[model samples]
Target: MIYLRRMDYTVIVYHLLFHLLLLTLGFSPAFCFFSSIKNTFKWGVQSVGNAVCSGVNCCDFHLNDNVEENLTKLLKDKLFGQHIAASLLVEALSSHRTHKSQKALGIGLHGWTGTGKNYVSEMIAESLYKQGMRSPLVHVFAGRASFPDGDEVKKYRKDLLTWIRGNVSDCGHTLFIFDECDKWPVGLIDVIKPFLDYHSVIEGVDYRNAIFLFLTNTGGSAIGQRMLDLHEEGVIRDKLKFEDFHDEISLSLFNEEGGFFKSDIIRGDGIDFHIPFLPLEERHVRKCAERQFELKGYSNPTGRMIEDVLKNMLYGPTSNPIFSMTGCKRVHSLVLSVIARLKLEL
Candidate 1:
C-alpha cells in the first residue's frame, strides 16, 4: 500500500466531518454539497430530486403558451359572477404574454367587498407561477397591513420604490399585487407609477414583462348603481359589457378618497383595464355555498343545508334586496358552522 501524507489525512478528516455534519442536519451528503455549489454558481446545475425553481434563471419565469388557456379555465371554473372581468382579464393577459409589451400590464379591479376580487387575483397568481402565491417572484401587499399610518407616506414610498426596483431587477416577470387599494394612503401608490409607465426601461431595469394588479372596493357603489340601472332597463345581467361600467368605475376610483383618489395613475392612462366586478346575486351566493361544500369534502351537500347557508347571508337594497350584501365572502365560514351543527345533531 502506498504511504499517505499528513496533508492528505487532514483533508480526508475534514471532508468526513463535513459530510457527518450534513447528515446530522438531515441533509443527504451528496445532495447538500451539490446544492450548495448549484446555488453559488446558478448555472448549468441540474436539480437533484424534486427541486423547485429558485427564481434564478429558472423555467418558472418564462411565460408559456398554456398560461392563457390555464387562466381562462381557472376563471371559468372557479370564479362565480362578473363575466366582463373574466373576459377582459383573459384577453389582456393573453395579449400581454404573447406580444412585446412596452410597460408592465397594470390592471385595476374595482368592486364591492367579497365580490371575488381577491379570489380572481389569487387565480391569476396561480396561473402565472407554478407555486402560485407562494412563488418568490409573486409579491402581495395589503394596504391596511402594509402601511397602516398615513403620516409615514414618505417612508412607505421610499421602501416601496426600493422593493419594486430590486424585485424587477431580479426577475422581469415578477407579479406585484396590491390588495385593498381603497385603504392605501392617497398618493402612496403613485410611487410605482414609473414602473407601470410605457417606458421600455426605467433606470437599468425593464419592467415590461411584469404585471401589476390593483384590487379596490372604492367603486362598489358606482358599480352597484350601474347594475341596478341596467336591470331596470331590461338589460340581462349576462349581456352586460365592459363599456357599460368602465367609465363609471374609473370616475368613482378617481374621485374616491381611497388609494386612487385624485392620483396621477388615474389622471393618466396608467391603468390598462379597469375591470368591474358586479355584485353577486342570490343565485351566485348559492353557487359559492355549493363550491364551499365541495371543497370541504361534503360532496353531496343537501338542499336544506344550502338554504340554511343562504338564509344566514345578508342581501342589499332593503326595498328589493337584489344582491348579496357581503357576497360570497362569508360562505366558507358559514359552511363550516353548518357542518359542525349537523355533525352535533347526528
Candidate 2:
C-alpha cells in the first residue's frame, strides 16, 4: 500500500462531497461524473464545482409548472381586446397540459394584422417555456420566408417532414408555429398531416404531446365583416362567443386562395380550433398606445400624448371610422415619434 499525501486526501474528500451534493439534488452519479470530471481536471476542484452547478442550472428544461396561472396572468395583464381568443387559448392549453391527448393540439389563429395573433402566440410560448420563443424546443416557420415558390413544394415538403421528425424525436413536448400560413403554396401543409393526426406514434415518435399553431390573415376580411354586422346588431364585442364567428371563419379558410383552401387538414378535422382574432376599436388602440409609452420608458404618458398617438393612427370604414385599420402594429414607432416631438416642446 502507498502512503497518501494530505493534499491527495483533501482532493478525494472534495470530490466525494461534490458528487454527494449532486446526488442529493437528483442527478445520477454517472451524469454528475461525466458533467464535472473534465472541468475538475482542467480547472481544479473549486472552479469545476461552480461550473458544474451552473451548467446543471442552465441546462434543465424551462417549462413552468403553473402553466394556467402564469398564462392567464400574462394574457389579462398585457394583451388588449379579444376576450374570447384569450379565454379559449387559456382553456385549451390548460386542459391539454392536464390530460393525456390522442392527437397533437392544433390551433389556427386567423385575423388581420396587429390583431394579437402573433402576440398571443408569444404569450403562450412565454407561459410554457421560461425562454419563450427563443427556446430550442419552439420552432417558428414563415410561409413566404420558408417556402416562397410554388414549384419547390416537393422539396419543401421533404425538408419540413425531416425537421419536424428530428425535433420531436429530440423532445416530444415541442411547439411548432407556422406564421403567414396563408402565403404557403397550395397542398404544402399536407406534408405534416400524418404527424398531426391521431396516430399513437409516427416512426417511433409519439407526437401527441406536441403543439402546432398556424397563424394567418386568410380570414381577416370575413372576420372583420362579421364583427361589423354584429356591432350593427348591438352585440357587445366582449360578449361575442367563439360559436358566433367560427362558421364564418371556417368557410373563409376553406374557400380562400391560401394554404388551407380545400385542404385535407380542414376536411379531416385535424385543426382542433380555428380561433378568430377580432378587430380593435379606438379604445383598444388607446390602451395599446398607453402600454407602448410605458414600454418605451415613459411611465406616466399624459392625455395629450395619448391623443397625439391616436390622431396619428388611421381608423376606418369611410362612413364610420370606429376601428383601427392597422391595429397596434405601428404603435411602437408611432410612440417613439410622439415622444421625440414632445421632448422638443419641453
Candidate 3:
C-alpha cells in the first residue's frame, strides 16, 4: 500500500514540475522557436480556406512552370483555327513573366461565338496549375455566374478587391480570368483598373505577379466581316494572318458604337495583348470532330461522324457559307449524339 501511494505521488509531482518548466520557458527563445515550428507545420498541411499567411514559412510555395513549351504544344495540337491568338498568348505570357517591374499580363480575347476564347484561357490555366482549372489561385469570374443581379454586381467590386488583395499579398502569384466581360455591367471591369495599374502596388498588395484574361464576343461583327472579305478574295482560312485583324476588333471596343462596345479596360489601354480568334472554317470544324473522336477512342466511324456533324451545323454568310454558327462549341455534343445513335442501331 505504501509503495503504490509513493508511485502515485511521484507521477503527479513529475507532471507538475514538467508543466512549471514549460511555463518558465514560455518567455524564452526556445518557446518561440517551437511555437513557430508548430505553426509552420500546421499551415503547410491546412489548405487555408481563404488566405492565411501566418506562419514562419507561410509564403513558401511550389514554383509553377511558366508557360513556354507546354502552352505552345497545347495551342497548336488542341486548338484548330486560332493561330494569331495562340502565338500572341505565348508571347505575352512569356514576356510578361520576365518583367521585374510590371510583371503582369492583361490579355483580351475577342471573336465570334465558339472561337476558342474560353478554351484558350482554360489551356493557359491548365498549364499554370497542374491540378488544372480547379487551382485555388485561379479566380474565374463570369458576370452571370459571379454577379447574377444588380445587388450582386454592386457587392462584387468590394469582394473582388478584398479577394485579389488577400491572395496576392499572401503569395504574389495569381491568375484572374474574367469570362464574358462584355456581359459584365458597364463599370464592373473598371473595378479591376487599380490592380491592373503598372505601378508596383495599389494598397500595399503587389498585383504584378498576376495574369488577367478577358474573354468576350465584344468584336464579333468586325471578325465576321474580315473573314467574309477574305473568303471572297480567295484567301484560304488556314492562310489568314494577324494583320487581317490589326484594328477592327479592339478599335471598335473604344469607339462606343454600341452599348456593349463600351469597356473602360480597353479605353484605358489596360489590356496588353488583344488576340483575335478568327471564325472557324468547315475544315476547322472537321478537325475538331476528328480530335473529339480521338479523345473517345472511336475508329472506322470517325470519318462518317465528322461529315454528319459538319452537315448539321449551320454556317453564316449565305454568299460565302464559311463560319460555323457555334464554331466547335457544338462539335463535342454533336459527336456524342451521333455515337449514341450509332450504338442504338448496332
The global C-alpha lDDT for each of the candidates, from Candidate 1 onward, is 0.86, 0.85, 0.75
lDDT of 3 by residue, 249-311 (tens): 757687634323565566777877778898888989988888888788784555677898899
Better of 1 and 3 by lDDT: 1
Q: List the residue pairs that clash in candidate 2.
A: none
- C-alpha root-mean-square deviation, candidate 2: 8.5
What's the distance in Å from true for residue 132, model 3? 1.8
Q: Tens digit of lDDT per residue, candidate 1, span 1-346? A: 2344566456556655665688789998788677655443442233221233455455454434478888899999988887999999998998898899888999999888989999998889888877788778888999889999999999999999999999889888899999999999988999988888889988899999999999999889999988988888899999999999977887797788988988988887788989999999999999999999999998889999999999999998776689998989999999999999999999
Candidate 2 TM-score versus the reference: 0.83
lDDT of 2 by residue, 222-321 (tens): 9888889899899988899999898889889889999988889888888888898988998998899999999989889999989888898888777667
Candidate ranking under lDDT, highest first, comes to 1, 2, 3
Regions of candidate 2 where Cα sits further than 4 Å from its true position:
1-60
After superposing all C-alphas onto the true structure, candidate 3 shows an RMSD in angstroms of 11.1
| True-structure RMSD, every candidate | 8.1, 8.5, 11.1
Best by TM-score: 1
Better of 1 and 2 by TM-score: 1
